[model samples]
Target: MRLAWRGPTMLVTDVRGELGRGVTSTGLWFRETRYLRTMRLLVNGRAPHLCALGGQDARTLDLVYVHPELEQFGGGGSGLARSEESLASDGLPHRSIDVRVSHAVQLDGLESRYVVANRSRRVARLVIDVALDCDWADIGDTIGDREAPVRIWARAVCDGSSLELRSTHPQLRYVTHVEAPGASAHQSGVRWTLELAPRDEVVLPLRVRAIDFEDALTGEGIAAREDALARWRASHVVVDTTGHGVEPLVIAAALEDLASLPLLEGRPREWLAPQAGLPIYPALFGRDALTTGWQASCVDGGAMLDAALARLGRLQCTRDDPRIDAQPGRIPQQVRRGPRARLGDGAFAVSYADVASPLMYVISLAQLFALRGDEALIRPHLDTARRILDWAHEQAQGGFLHYHTRSSDGPEHQGWKDSGGAMVHADGSSARSPIAACEIQGYWFAAQELLALVLWMLGRRGDARALWDSARDLKRRFHRAFWMEDESFYGLGIDREGRLLRSVTSNVGHCIASGIVAQPVIERVVERMFAPDLWSGWGFRTLSSAHPAYEPLSYHCGSVWSVESTTIALGLRRFGLDRRALQLADATLALASLYPGFRVPECVGGYAKDEMPHPGAYPRADLIQAWNVSAIPGLLHAMMGFFNVAPLDLLTIDPILPTCLDRVRVKGLRVGRGVIDLDVWRDRDGRSHFDVTRREGTLHVVRQPPPESISVGIAGRVRALVEGLLPS
Candidate 1:
């Protein structure tokens, strides 16, 4: 079994509580570097047998182990053998023991508590040893099969109760400080010897801290770190649920995961920005952060959204650089900060890939404005938004947003599906670069329209009109160029010379959400989405299973991504396909429930439901992905269609609750300067109804699809004077 815990940093380990060994990507990582590559425990010179392993929360892990039988240790004398036999006959192993190891990994250090209990009737002598080592490898080396170029040398120094292991390389230096009370320092590691009475237990506390070579070491205890974690969790938005099965629990877990992903320091503008995931990508990613912030806006009241936009805006590229594929006004794809991330190597501090990041930034800014009518916050960023728009217009040559990476180390398919061979021709050959992906065009269209709204709201009607016209022209050309009549769906993308790639994929589903596809084409698109080759019953596969390149476990070839599923579900709802949208939502929730903590992974195998009862885990997938966790809130948005029009001071909700959910109540939902409580329930007649149980301030509530509109004040009077206000 594999387990992971992440605070500001992350630690990944296996059931034996060992780091990297034999194709396992387990390690202790900070700032995009592996600080400790090996940490294992042994009892009596042999590894213990693991009985159970799990965690109490997102930041703690526990492993239970048992010692081997005394016979396996080779009985030294006849007396020992006779005692073992006598104990076996009595149903107790005479020399057996049980060990429990609990690990609490914090932002700057790790604390491990070990409890050893002797279960036998005879006193036993045991030696406990902890092996420690570090390679100081760069995180990029671990992603592929590439080995690290630097060699690290470790020097161990024993100082009283502490054992300090300092690792040095040409590029970086760090130290791992270990403290074990009542333990002696040995040449190999710290050792503890115990002479236990029958049924006696020993408790050993070990603490490890990773410090930068240049920074001064401070003695901060585990309690202080845990208190900091508590404060961080307390600052998050709270979601209260009523009449639900696991929905509240799942939401809480997702929020905890998100809170743990915030960067410790070295972020642009020093604002709190969430990394993409743990272990592999504890770095800022533009697209992932933008989407997570957008989904979290309903609960967080646009705080994360605002911070993400500001950070991305600050890192916006200002000049063209062929090495990193940096372009003017383009948002950086990913940012790496550490001593090892240097130029001239494959790892660059800031690199560019897909053009979608800038488009996503624009879209999220519009959403933030809608959630909060804070002109002060948005007015300062209009110039940045306009610069991005200008760059986007320049890239729309021949009527579509196209991308081709100039950097040799940059990604080939520069979209959400950045894996090699993701973009392919109908014959299964890799599609040529400078490819115009269908989803990128959808994002471009959406960005233009939303930015236009932002301009119009700011009294720049002339600029807004130009943007609106550009969006219309792009939509017209998109329908003519991307629609494949023979296949009855949109092509995956267009190649360099403008020939269609002619591969059916989930990318086209994004067009529906962007409102770029015509009304007549929506039914056919929805029909294609539900086809057996596309829908895996758990979620929509990234590539159709009928495609020759399809691989169920492949990263982007034929895997189910929760983030994509959420986008497609929202599109289905936009076109009035409510049943299909709800089906997708329920399937996604079911998949999340199968994993521990109800935490959704980055992606899963695209196996058909009939072939497997549960979704298969994709090897190397990030376990705690941000956008994937955002699916819960995305599903809620689909069901309720909640949007805050802050300019009008109105909260609009057009709820279409799924049949699977009988009732739901949301409390303390923040909208603009007010908060509201909502209660929604479905009657036996299969009709859904909602009530605003509580309201504050002058924020008006608007519900759609025709009920006689009633003033809240008069409605309250009627509710108090007569039987509860009659159902619409």
Candidate 2:
């Protein structure tokens, strides 16, 4: 069997086996990560077309075309695009190779059997050659680099076929360029060609020259370029190449099998529209009715969230950082820093600027761990996770996290928006050091609560109770310190002296998001947030326009963030304010429609109802922001009222779709036990019906309906109910 490993950056292929062996078919396997939509098959394959090779289409492949800027990864000049070859591509030639792997085979005692079958309308012939004229080099040691390279040389021969290939300059580079070969390979044999009829097979040979090399920076861009090359070569080493050629055909056939598997396709329709094209956000909104677009693609909100959380886990920091050595499990508060700050190279950084966010990471991870019920998945990071939490418990300064190391450099402010001027005094002036961000406190309480839940799931009764106790203390301290009695809204931040930095913004939503709000406080906070003062006609603003510092386009002052709104909506749902959450979902969808793609903008101006008919677009916004796009589907999940019935082996769908959506269908949805095609529609009379059919599991129909609005006291009980309905 062939081993495969899929990564965020690239897919690797290693061909093994000798000239003659029992022919076998190829099979492709991947862990169904949503971000990576397409499977790009290299080498010899059965299928000739890309459509047959599943995954994301070429158009939707986000990472393929990364941000051009070369941000340093390890140290000086070691960034994502910080390679010598990458520097050459800065203004130099670049090449796009569209490889079509048609077929492969192995010769067994003169019986030329098939391996990969050509599945195209016409026959295919691939001219596989390694030219030396082009600029290519073996990636070796460099800054911010990981992994090693291997070397070897081998050849393949099909007894009765003509296939020609050559490798002159064995050096490799990640960035492909178009240049004349400096030297051509001296091949003793003539050009070989293997004719492949429709669904026909062919076999090819493999070779590699993997070896370690010392670090060198021959040019200004050489070190970085070498690093990129080395990274690529490390992932593609052929660990075992002793197998006979028979496996090549088997591997090719497996890829064919994946290509033919039927996919759950979404109904195709023209979703984007031609707007004024003023900016990215508004252009997305200027199209058709917003509610209709939202209703159409509202299926599997929970699944999307689950996928994002899972993807987020993959991007977690597996490497240790020296900055937050005292508190390791903590997640970095911010992935990117403002001007001139060193962004941590590892996937997970313990500190933001200089402040540790142990509580935030712990809480997010615990919540995800509970959601998936996969303890082993998180076990690898549990040590660091525990240490982070332990450090946070010790570092709690006056009911908040403060004055702790956040980065490799040193300690800095740790908050969602730790901008220079964000931590203002109660009189609207900036605060001094050792400040406490209200959201951090919220995250603290939230983390404790989530960890408590995780402990309960893990059967640590005593530990779970203790964690709950700590969380209860945090909730009390938070309410006492952050509550603004006069304004009836929570404070945005608190100085060391514990003075409330009163600002009527969505930051209070963080409090609710932590799930520590008492019912009475929840009502008050919700009222204050949705009130006219805080809510704009478009959606809730980051900060209320009534504030003296309000700027509609302000990054953390007043602009709207889809991610923030979605999280707030989830909090509202947990608080049994489903209608309010649904309303926000509708507003968010309307706002998203104004943008270029159905995807949400990073932030948009929070124009008031009368100030502007439509929300204005922020001048600088990223079009394809990950979390922003993720939030939309999550918002839908909250609005549509989708939830797993759990241990019951059944799905309980209580549609809360707005009256505007007449019908919605989610086909080939994978859920608890197996795949199910779900169809939800609202009749003219305004009644909602949910029909679900099992596509791949033993039938388990549960007549019991889930809570239409809220799930109070329905924690683990829901799991039992769902499991009871499953076919025993």
Candidate 3:
């Protein structure tokens, strides 16, 4: 068993309450550098017997252990003196002992508390030792299974009761400080000898700090950290569910995980940026951040989107650099701040392998603009947005958006499904470079339309018309090139030679969700999406099970990604496939409940529902992924059919709740200049009812009539209304 905790960084420990595995993964890491590679505890030259392990919060772990029964009885005492003899005769050991270990992790360091107790009729003596070492390896090197350079070195220095281990390399300098109050420092670590009488106990406290290059330890205690965590949790919208089995728990866990992932300090700027996930990608990723922020728009009232847009704007690529795949106007794929991150010839801190990140950035900004009519927040970034849009236009010169990794060390594939073997033909052979993924085109179409809307709001009619025309042309070409007429489904992508990579995948769902697929073909695509080959009961599989390349446990070929399923569900609702959308939403919620803490993972094994009890776990998936956790809020919004164009002073509600969720209430839902508290419930006759219990501000509520009455140009009408609100 393994236990883990995360704050601004992350720590992982094995069952023995030690980090001495020496494997590529186990250790303390900050800013993509492994700080402490090995740490072990020994009692009387032997490891303690494990009893139980649990965590009270995301940042604390508790472990209970005990010595061997024979060792506790004083090792073959012949005479069995007095009380010891009586205890042995009564079938009890001469001494009963217990060891409890508690680990508390903070933004800057870790504190561990050890308690030893003797609960028998006799006294006991114990020897305790803690062993430690550091390798100072870069996380990328560790994950890639490459060896660290020999220039890296570690040195330990002792000063009285405290010890410090420092690792240095050309790119990074790391230090770990250890302090044990009453213990003596040695070459191995610190040591302690203790004597405890009957029912007596002793407590030992140890502190380990991962010091920043220019900052000193503030010596803040656990109380301060807990207070900070409480404030952070209080900043988000609160949610509660009534008469639901797992809904309340799911909401609570989602909010908690979101609060835990924010970078507390030491970022490029003072603003908070969410890390991708824990124990692995605890760094800023452009795609993950934008997706998470968009999904969390309703909960945070677009605050996440606002911050993400600003941060990405600051980190946007300004020049062409083939070494790191950096191109002007491109958003970074991933950003790491550490010494080893500076080793590359080009700027390695920001890599531009993700072709979809800039499009995601544009979509997120549009989402924020729709939620709040604050042109003031977006006005400053319009120039950056136009630059990204221009880059997209240049890349799509051949009638489709394509990507080929320019950096030798960059990812082979650039879309969300970026694994090496993700893009393959029906024969299981990999697709060639410069591939045009189905979803990238969808994103490009959406981004162009969204930017056109933004331009219209700003009274730039010519620019708006040009963008809309480009979007329309791309949509037409996408329909003609990517649609598989014989199969009644869309192909995964087009290879470099202009041949369709005929593999059925979940990317088609994104096309529908993005409104890139033609209206006539949407129903057919949705029908095929919900068929047995694509819908795995848990969620939508990245690739169809019927495909020759399908492997349930493969990273990208065959996996159920919550984020992808959420996107498809949103798209289904957009196109009026209410029943199918509700079905997918319920399946995603059910999958969340199957995970350990009700926290969704980055991806799960794509197994058929009837064939397995629950979704199989992907071996290396991030357990608390930001986008995956955001799926809860995304699902809620999809089921409720809530959409807002705040600038136009309009709100639309089209309830399509599943039967399982009889009643749903969303309180403190912020939009535009006010908050909305809404309740929707089902009557005995199965009809849905809506009540706006509370509405603040001048928002016009429009309850969508039925499927047939919904006008074909409703989206266009909303955009026009928003444009009309702007001053001429």
Question: Best candidate per TM-score, number?
Answer: 3
Q: Could you arrange the candidates by lDDT from highest to lowest?
A: 3, 1, 2
**How much is the lDDT of residue 218 in candidate 1?**
46
How far in Å is the alpha carbon of 43 misplaced in model 1? 2.4
User: Candidate 3: lDDT of 705?
Assistant: 29
Model 2, 1-728: lDDT tens digits are 12121111112111321110121111111111111111222222221222222223211111111112232344444444433344213231121113323221100001111133344445455333321111111111100122212222223222222312222324321111111122122222212234556556544322111111221112333234334323432322121111223322222222222111111111111111111111111111101111112211223212222222232223334445556433333433332111112123331222334332345446545644533345665565455556656767766676577653334554344566644555665455666556777777777777677777777777888988987898888778777877887888788777767666887877778677667665566777787888876788667787777777777887777787667787787678666676676677667666665544354556778887678876766664644333454455456456545544323444445455554455555554444445566556666676556566436664244423334324444654475355434443
> Candidate 2 or 3, higher lDDT?
3
Give the per-residue lDDT of model 1 (tens digit) for 188-222. 56789888888999998988777766543244533
State the C-alpha lDDT per candidate.
0.75, 0.43, 0.76
Against the hidden true structure, what lDDT does model 3 obtain? 0.76
Q: What is the TM-score of each candidate against the true structure?
A: 0.88, 0.56, 0.89
Error of 2 at 163 (Å): 25
Q: Model 3 residue 498 lDDT?
A: 89
- Candidate 2, residue 250: Cα displacement in angstroms equals 41
Candidate 3 TM-score to native: 0.89
Model 3 ranges with Cα > 4 A deviation: 1-7, 69-95, 144-152, 168-171, 214-232, 265-270, 345-348, 685-687, 705-728
The alpha-carbon deviation from the true structure for residue 584 of candidate 3, after best TM-score superposition, in angstroms, is 0.3
Worst 10 residues of 2 by lDDT: 105-114
